[model samples]
Target: MKLGDVAKLLGGRLEGDKNFEIEGVSSVENPKPKTLVFCSSKRDVERVKDIKQVALVVHTPVQDANCVVVEDVKYAMAMFLRIFYPEEHPSGVSEKAYIGEEVIIGEGVYIAPFTYIGNKVVIGNHVKIYPFSYIGDQCLIGDETVIFSGVHIYPRCVIGKRVRIHSGAVIGADGFGYYIGKEGITKLHHIGSVVIEDDVEIGANTTIDRALIDRTIIGRGTKIDNLVMIGHNCKIGENNIFVSQVGLAGSVKTGKNVVLAGQVGVADHVSIGDNVQVVAKSGVANDLEANGTYGANLPSIEWSRWKRIYLYLLKLPELFKKGS
Candidate 1:
């Protein structure tokens, strides 16, 4: 593709030589010859100027190099990659797979080997389910969904369009609800379901618990990373990016585009507003408003500070001795 063609495809303004041909896409730091590079920041512009490349996908015009300016650099990158490597959809139940009675499978569905799909389930078009996947009864999966190996989805769960549930992700496991009893603790039954909205991608080993009385709702375009624990009755909103090992306690409500970094822990019943960025390892103990960014505290204190605090605290012994 040529530099002008890339600009036209991404709906951007090209302020460069249209004659240059790009063989492929590459990073700005180490540019491959005749490859498209991206410069989304002014700092990146200086970083990529001298490197040999065909053109740059940028928010501003490159000082002396070929430039294509777009409204959003990241969106343009996604679009360009989509165009560059177009996906070919696959279909049909595998010879090694097994299907239960009254099952409703849609067009262009690929059910792989050793998989079990239960009755009265509506699986939508272009759905690719890999090996050992188990979909329980009355589940509704929307179009273009992809279920990877060893995924166990419980009954009555609603998985929406373009949703990708990766390997070993257990959807709708029974929630941890117990009460004090005469003999011991008794388990409360979980009767509610999980509703995963459109364009949500769940990473491997993630477990979303079923609710005790109501539903657990994951909103649109939320990408949850591996090992995330989403408890019952939690409502997560649109386009949120949850990194690995983030744990949301029960009944937590979050607004749109909230970013939860790695190992972030949310307390129960708390409400977080839109565009709030929770940094890595931060413990969210209260509510957060929209567009808020918090920097977490460092655990390791300076040695002198620690010693001084320790010595100040040890004056209790001196006070006791003086009193005696």
Candidate 2:
């Protein structure tokens, strides 16, 4: 597409050679000749003119270069390229797919080969189950949900519409619950279900545990990052963002719009309020109030002071070697 055509396609204003043809989209730092490069923010405006690409996408016009200015440069660039190089939407089920008995597969469902749909499972319309996916017994998958390759949904899991279950995600895993009995140490029973609400995107290899007698619920639009572990009976809130490797203990409750950054750990039975933002690697041992930010595992301090303090502490063992 030409630079002028790309700008029209992306709903952006072009301030360059309208006849310049753009083959693809790329980054400004490493621009491909025919490809259109994009700027990150206003700070990238300085380098926009020096970019080697034919077309550049930025928020405002840059001097001495062919550029397309848009409200959201990155989003506009993405939309522009996706239109030209569009990914194939998931379509029909293949003949080689292993569909189980009593499986109610809905219309427009894409069932890849070797996928195991268990008994009494109701798959919704436009759902895509990639190869090697395992949907366990009696599961209900909502419409437009995509279960990626190697995903394992255990029995009775209720997945909602437009939910994206990434590769290797294990839903409805057994809870880490145990109890002491008269005979010996016995394992507690897990008899609950996992209900994932609409527009939630579960990351790869993440495990969400089932409850003891109720439900482990994930609210709408909650985006969980890769390698996170959500323990049993946790009630996650709507539009929450849980970053990579976050660990939420059992019975934890979060209100709407909560944000947990990378590697944050929440203790069991803690109730976090709405709009809370936990920083990266935070160890949240207590409850967080609404709209509050707390729990930093890594303390921010002056590097020079920390180095001096560490150096003094390191000489303690040597100073007291053979004496007091």
Candidate 3:
């Protein structure tokens, strides 16, 4: 695609050579000729000034390079990649796949080899269940969803449309619930299910547990990264982003657009409000209010307070010695 055509498609203002033929998209740090890069900030614009590769810049226009000024560079990049580098899904059901009794598979679905579809399961149109995937009994997989290899969906779970569950992901597994009895500890059985709403993307090795009662719900457009653990009865709101290694204990509730960064741990029954941003390695023990950037230990403080608290902690030992 030509630079001018790309800019027109992205609704961006074209600068420099409009006729430059673009081959692929890449990052500015690794500038490749004929590839389109995205400059997300003014600093990125300055960094890509001397870069010869084509760029998609936000707000700022590069003087020397062939650039397209877009309102949102990241969104444009995602659109461009979707158009240019569309994923190739496997076609047709494999003969080696095992379909159990009363299974209802829709048209255009692909069931790969070694996949097991349990009894009374309903797989929607164009859904792809890859090799070694296990769809348990009474599960409902929505249209256009892709379940990658080694994925296990436990019985009665519901996966919504346009959802992408990557390899080794386990949905609706029994949560870590136990009861104290006179005899000893008794294992609490999970009687509920998991409901993953539309446009959600669950990464590899991520486990979403089944609730003790009702459902463990993942709201629409939520993106959960690899190795994340969402415990039983958690209610995750729409468009939330949980980074890798983030762990949510049982019954944790998050409002819309919440972001929990890498390694952030939320204790059981904690409530995270809408538009909240928890920084990396945060330990959230108490409830968080909306529209603030929080970080550090339990009862996550605002970013500014966290910085001050962190600085004061370094001088604590010296202050204690002087007082003694």
Q: How far does residue 35 in candidate 2 sit from its true spot (Å)? A: 1.7
As a TM-score, model 1 comes out at 0.88
- lDDT leaderboard ranking: 3, 1, 2
Q: Rate the local accuracy (lDDT) of all candidates.
A: 0.90, 0.89, 0.92
What TM-score does each of the candidates earn?
Answer: 0.88, 0.87, 0.89
How far off is residue 251 in model 3, in Å?
Answer: 0.9
Tens digits of per-residue lDDT, candidate 1, 18-81, equal 8789899878677778888877888776776454465888887766688889999989999988
Q: Write the per-residue lDDT of candidate 2 for residues 245-300, one digit (tens) a residue.
A: 99999999999999999989999999999999998888888888898988767577
Off by over 4 Å in 3: 45-50, 53-58, 297-324
- Please give the lDDT score at residue 112 for candidate 2: 91
Model 1 misplaced stretches (Cα beyond 4 Å): 299-324
Estimate the lDDT of model 2.
Answer: 0.89
The superposed Cα distance between candidate 1 and the true structure at residue 304, in angstroms, equals 8.2
Better of 1 and 3 by lDDT: 3
Which whole-number lDDT from 0 to 100 does residue 47 have in model 1? Answer: 73
